[model samples]
Every structure is written in C-alpha cells, then in structure tokens.
Target: MEAAVNDQPRRGDTEGFVLQVRKIGNSVGLILPKELVARANLREGDRLHVAELADGSLQLSARDPHFAKGMESAGKAIRRYRNALAELAK
Candidate 1:
C-alpha cells in the first residue's frame, strides 16, 4: 500500500491500487484493502465480472459491460427480424 493522503487513505497517488495475486490453498486470489472493500460495497458472495481489453489489460467490475451491449444488439435483431423469425418458427 502506498502512502495515504490527508484524512483519507487511498490506494495510491494515481488513484490506482497495485495489487499482488497470492496463492490461497489451490486457488489464487488478491486481497483488497478494507478501505476499498468498504468503498465498493462488495460482499463475499457478490459476483464480479472480468473483461480482457484489446490492450491486454484486464478489468474487473460488478457488471458485465459486454452483456448490456449484447442485449441491446439482440433487441435490435429481434425487432428487425420478428416477422421472419415468427414464420420460421411456424
């Protein structure tokens, strides 16, 4: 953990946390600081989504970014091909 600012302890000066992945039994995990966990409102059973970007970096978030876009695309396709899909189903 880097040095904290006045009155508040953040991950670092750049607002980024440099975490190290550690081995836990047979699995590997990273430990988040108490400040971060409380800030994010994350729980033990909560699910986190991981996305690999084009720059070879990984992103972790509470929601899947691609899921929303995929759902939007699916909705458009369904609206555009509703008649054809209905006929094919029949």
Candidate 2:
C-alpha cells in the first residue's frame, strides 16, 4: 500500500490493489477495487468527478458545488428555451 497521509487512514489502500485500465469507447477506464466502493458509499452507475492536479496526478471526488452552479445555468437555459419547447411540442 502507498504511504498513508495525515492522521486518517483511507480504506482503499490498506493493501494496495492493482487497477487494470481498459479501453471503453474512445476513453480508457480504471476498475476500482470493490472495497473502495463500500468505503466511499458509491454504487454502480454513480457519477464521479475527476480533477487534474498540478503534479499531473488525477483526483477523484464526489459531487462538488460547481455542479450546483452548472445545474443553475441549465435551469436558466431551460427557462430561456421554454417558448421554443412549447412551440415544438405544439
């Protein structure tokens, strides 16, 4: 397992598992260990956000407040297109 940081111990790296990268459509995906899923309370078909760190490493996190802002923008777009959608429906 990689060195644990901070005073907290994360569940996924207790013994360090190998993740296999596979090609899915045009992008590659990594299969996370099942223990990680349980620890993070994540389930299949759930969404995860990936962030690119300054050190060239990827950070995986749950939903962020930025997503709420994006949702608000989408709501504004829906309001703006309400007339168009109504016309299309008719």
Question: For every model shown, what is its TM-score relative to the native structure?
Answer: 0.59, 0.49
**Pairs of colliding residues, candidate 2:** none
- Report the C-alpha lDDT of model 1 over 5-51, residue by residue, as the tens digit: 33233366687776666666787877777777788889888888888
Best-fitting candidate, scored by lDDT? 1
Cα-based lDDT at residue 45, candidate 1: 85
- Each prediction's RMSD to truth: 6.1, 9.0
TM-score attained by model 2 = 0.49
Question: Tens digit of lDDT per residue, candidate 2, span 1-90?
Answer: 232233232344556555555566787876676777798899999989988999998777877759888999999998999999889999
